[model samples]
Target: MAFLGFESKVFMAPMAGITDAPWRTILAACGAGNLISEMAAINAIQRKNPKSWQIANVKDEPYPVVVQLVGNNPELFADAAKLVTDLGAYSIDINMGCPVKKIVNNHAGSALMCDLPLAAQIIEATIKATPLKVSVKFRKGWDNEHINAVEFAKMCENSGASYITVHGRTRAQGYAGVADWNIIGEVKSAVKIPVVGNGDIDSPQKAEQMLQQYEVDGVMLGRAMLGNPWLLHRTHHYLQTGEILSEPNASQIRQMLLKHLHLLVNYYGEHSGMAISRKHIGWYVKSMYDAKRFREQYTKLNTLSAAQDLINEYFLRIEA
Candidate 1:
């Protein structure tokens, strides 16, 4: 069953530098949920920044793309909503859950949680700007001392948001401490719009736990998904079949790493692709034999062919 035009209820939470076009294409291969682009600043979109536009681009993607925008200006958000709608986004997600210092210093991202009236105005402006569904992603609250997930969720719904996603941590938490899933439930109980829970959902079991325990409509997989592209497919399969699929073996991991590298090369050209592939290469080799030593050597590589040769030899030695 489709949730918001996606094949599954699970969602890929947007992460800067990681959920680019090449990564999404790889993560969508075996199974998929709603795929979100990295958050693009509304200011950049309005200024017609090419890098920002490329981050939000989904023209050739085969699946529905949810473009997440971050900013506090209502007028700019309205203008951005219009631009993404024209660019063919399936929906626009307002980013009120980001806890980055630069974003918060600008009164955007999770910082909007502290200013309810302004947040409402931004949501309302974007809703009126386009025909596409508009959702808002936010945290539990500005902090523990000012818990307001329920209030925040209600504000979004009242302002005409299509749905809401709660990243069960407060802005003050900044990815530390356990995510308070109960706050997500509180938001769910307070709103008529569908609620999706985010944060600390690293495995399929955790994703299902959010759905069944908190009664959230869906779950968003975050940072834990960095090197593990198959996580979306694995979680989706577990939800539908109640089966625990095995993690990819070394050989299979190699195949995916190469596949991702190839996509980055084709999409961004080999020069940039090889440089970008290093981080993923580190992730893909996690827990493999001699991984620490291999990573040291791989980092010195500057070309795709060099990386490929190293990977082939390293994985073969592991298999042997």
Candidate 2:
């Protein structure tokens, strides 16, 4: 069963400050399956925050977009679900596995994992509130000793969640250590619903291995996709045909970086856009010839043209 009618099995896990509209649109163009948006707070949506509304702005998006919501309040989540539905969200994903301190401090995010009753309420309320498909993203558990992914998977299924994505780390791990695909397999086994595995599937080979090893329904790529947009397409293609695709060469990288810069600038304006593109520029040129100094010079430039000139010259010098 395709979650939200997504035919492709490869998905993009939303990264805050990274999976904005421009980025999501780019990923859709790159041939990712259903795109999960950066998680926004249900409280902010209920309060009518412009930032929250901006995050839910998928009304005009050409690709299917799942607007993820995070909160401890089931009522607010119900309201936010309807609002996002009005904003054209293709589905909803509850953020039950965010391990950030501030979030858990407020009894939201992964904190909900420690309180399965409330988590169930949030999920069931969200599913009942929207005609759109509902999904949950969670971890192995709050900690190692409290490992309860299998139990949580059963809870999600019983609460009527249409899909689930299991990131193979606990709240305590917070992205460190190797992700346990074994837990993902366990979750897949514990529930009959579609289970998508996340975490540590960095390369095409690893992504394929996750599918083959964990027996998951799909794979979601997160940090690995930073600056490596082609990964989604390459991984998807490799899974479909078993043929590895060529990595983008120097010229191709240059072209992609330049296009990404323009997209950022157009969406966020020059000053902020140039500032944001610095990290992306670094990611794109990671480990390339003289990239350290190149990144330093790029950061110092305030104007888009200066940044553009730097990117072009640096890439050209590397090619020469």
Best by lDDT: 1
Off by over 4 Å in 2: 1-4
* Residue 315 in candidate 1, Cα distance off native in Å: 0.4
Task: Give candidates' CA RMSD values in order.
Answer: 1.1, 1.2
Q: Once superposed on the true structure, which residue ranges of model 1 sit more than 4 Å away at CA?
A: none
TM-score of each: 0.97, 0.97
The sequence of per-residue lDDT tens digits that candidate 1 reaches over residues 1-320 is 74656678899999998889998898878676778898999999988899899887787898888999999999999999999998879899999989999999999998999999999999999999999999999999988898899999999999999999999898999999999999999999999999999989999998998999989899999888878888888998999999988998889988998899999888889888888888988888877789999999998987788888999999999877
Residue pairs of candidate 2 with colliding backbone atoms: none
State model 2's lDDT: 0.89
In candidate 1, position 174 carries an lDDT of 91
Name the 10 consecutive residues with the lowest summed lDDT in model 1.
1-10
Model 1 residue 12 distance off true place after TM-score fit, in angstroms: 0.5
